[model samples]
Target: MSAASAFDDDIRRARALEQANPAEAGRIYMSVLEQDPANIEASNALERLNDPHRYSSWMRINCVIDPRDDIFRFIGTGPYSHNPIREYLSDGWRTLSELMVVMDKLDQPLTRVSSFLEFASGFGRFTRHLVKVLPGRVACSDVMPGSMEFAREQFGVEAFYSSFEPEQIEFPRRYEVVFVLSLLTHLPIEVWGRWLKVLAGAVAPGGVLIFTVHNEEVLRDQLGVKFDETGYSFLPSSESPSLEASQYGTSLATAQVVAEQVRQALGTDPVLWEECAFWVGHDAIAIRPHG
Candidate 1:
């Protein structure tokens, strides 16, 4: 190890601000750890950041966010344009809180789940806070290679590759909570249910598969969209940079349409569908097989 220099003073400042301004403190710790991953002071402080009860600001906001994470770009807005890094991290926590509510509705709290699968997880946005909550049990999957790796190395969890073709997407094993947040909201009409069927298969027996969608209300109100005869609509654009927009564009559907897709995907419809359960636009549909 190298001798400490001005970095020690930075750590001191971080310590002094821990209670008064944890967000700034965490940002400082993250900065230190980024420079010296072995710094005990910053490492220990980051460990504390994983506390579920700690303020949302306790987690380091910008430890390793790639500059290419387009979602981060999308989140940068208004005052956040100056420092979207902070809002990016807080926004993840917001998603976690929303999931907790869904779990409660399903009678399956986060504490009870033995394993979790975050499908289409991008760049550890929600994965970061999720690891703090689920820890060792968390697993992530995405077509983007670096994303899963980033989550595994930074957050300490399992990760695997997901393919564009639903039949080709492999899983190491089943999970009690298989969350496909926002992915369905973007899949093109041609292969929506095909992807849904494959994801549903990843859910352990008696477990829930929770996925989000842009429902009719959100489409009509937010995007001024009108669903076609198929009861859904899509546009060939999104925040992604790699995936072809034609296949991974934005999509919206009515609750009835989404429920039918779930039924057709899994041959059953034991789904708990809630409209505008989050983001005041995305609908959450959690499906579990019949007893």
Candidate 2:
């Protein structure tokens, strides 16, 4: 077989081995890379399998055996099926790729970033990849102390504990890139403004603040809620308590409402606004411009 065809076959085989035997899959990916250094798929697969911060065996068992954790339920749906570890690592790759594109759009070089912070990191799902992509100190924070500990131990990151109340939370230092993923989707409207301000405050001037929100697109597709004149919709945790509603439930914000909130928080409009920039899904991305 030709080089390209052989590479494709190896990738398929690696993917099949990934869930059942990640270490073996990693070796296959490494061999593919040796043959074709520029194989992005093989490189990404190898990285995911070889990540030092990957969840421990017991942690993987918990996610697969119990499936009670909200994080597992969120990413392990459909394609991931019952394999939460694969889902988790896949999300990290997807998130990193998206953020790189966003940074390129902003004309910000990932190499220039000296410090990165991932807010509401949730056991370092994305943090693990962030540490690999950026040549900087990657810090992760979450309201759950256990999650922070896990991130620190697994990823060798600077970990900190956050508070449920946004106003009470503080970072040790400013960051060139601050990412808030899946946090705003859970906050109530009253808490949104405060959290936005606090997270934006953590960004250094001329830096970028990236965040995700469940927008009207998600509301329509997932909840069967049509887009109304109002720019926001709230679904209490008591209502639909699955998927995006795993935690405090879901709040769907429109582009207009999210823009207004960012304006209120930063006193200026975002540099860029894109709907579904995350994984081509319902999440919206807004970037604060560099001064």
Candidate 3:
């Protein structure tokens, strides 16, 4: 068979394995390889069929697990609140491939900080990556205790309470870098302003505050952009927007406008905004200096 034909065969078989029994697929490939050690295709297929969850990199972040999977209460939803990273990765090959380029643009040393804070750390997918990239003391905080516990168990990092409410949790003397990926988008204007101020205060004078926001203008150009009927800022809604509800849950703005707002609210002197277009979304990286 031609190499192309063999490759096509592998793809078809792999899809079948995915649909039928991924577990069995791994065994089959291993069994075939034992019989004929020269079978490179079978070896490759087996490697490809290996469980994604088995990798430390994939499993170290437990927040990535489905929340509804017996650990958390289920409100009759099928499994969990949908795997965001899984969903993102489904279309994220290009995005994942561009990480090096993104890091290059940031140009910050990975080992510069002794401690770090990840706001809205989600399932800690990005946090795990950051942990590997950044050295020294690492602290992860999430709005959800479930997520914090999961991260603690999986990554072995110190987890802390991230809410504004008073709690026994004690933060370190200061953090060298405070990062919030996709966290600002969930906050309304007023709340975001407050968090930005608090975050600014938390950073050591020369540290970096890295964050992403829904840009107002570029989102207007996306295929399905819509405005809230409540006449608030243009927010894309799964359903119609109401005045009582703010756009936090439903709208995305252009990165440029978000950058501008951060400049006005945080510091006017030297905030750097970079437009990052990836497969999952368009984001701006705002590097704000502390104090």
Candidate 4:
């Protein structure tokens, strides 16, 4: 068969199987993996379907028992103190809803999985969001001991502290949904490749890897903002205009480039890439192929 025809055929078959027997979608995905072990899309679909317990555990651990400290009360009274945790966590839920729209278009169910490993999980907000909306288990790790401790005490999440250096950890098991939000925008570009490799290794084959980064165009439009090389803003609200400021977000290409670099570093491809316009740039969702 011609490449175009073969591609069309596979899409039709995959869509049909997904529509007719969504529950058995994993089995069909396994066949796709058999054809190409490194097919990230197939691997992700299978992974999300097969791991129910891990996802459920995450929801119970993070959502049911929040671990954040009362840091929300510490921010000075102003726009900063206006429920930052709720604002941040709700943003993640909004993003997840956008992803669900895509899944709905593809005639796929947004099934929950065993565990979601949220790296750089600041105060476990993303973990909190996932457990609340998705119904899954969560394992959150950060480089800051204070962040982890605060998260544990306040949010009741199973938090761990692992530094960006050496880039290693000893988790009990590989996570099914590994996520990194507003994380790459904090690290130096040179460090991202190593982090990507580590994150790839952290995910079980057939798991989904979600993350965010900046787009240069958006950054260009917001020039004069005091931003780190990764385009992270450190300015307080009084110092800069809200539009130009980072506000813990970046442009689409900034994230896309990092995701590509990470894929190259890991030698794996992402099944899906969603560049939504919530804050700015792209917050992509990638799935590694099953072996």
Q: How accurate is candidate 3 locally (lDDT)?
A: 0.51
Better of 2 and 3 by TM-score: 2
* Clashing residue pairs for model 2: none
**Candidate order by decreasing TM-score:** 1, 2, 3, 4
| Per-model root-mean-square deviation over C-alphas | 7.7, 10.2, 10.6, 19.7
Whichever of 1 and 3 has more lDDT, that candidate is 1
Give the TM-score of each candidate. Answer: 0.77, 0.70, 0.59, 0.55
Candidate 1 Cα errors over 4 Å, as ranges: 1-57, 60-62, 77-82
lDDT of 1 by residue, 21-74 (tens): 888888888887667543445655755665332234356442456544667667
lDDT of 3 at 59: 35
Kindly report which residue pairs in candidate 1 clash with one another. none
Residue 21 accuracy (lDDT) in model 4: 78
Local accuracy of candidate 3 as per-residue lDDT tens digits, 108-171 = 4545556677766654555555665553367778655477787676567777767653233355
Best by TM-score: 1
Tell how far residue 134 is off in model 2, in angstroms: 2.4
Give the Cα lDDT of each candidate. 0.76, 0.68, 0.51, 0.53
Give per-candidate clash totals: 0, 0, 7, 31
Superposed on all Cα atoms, model 1 deviates from the true structure by an RMSD in Å of 7.7
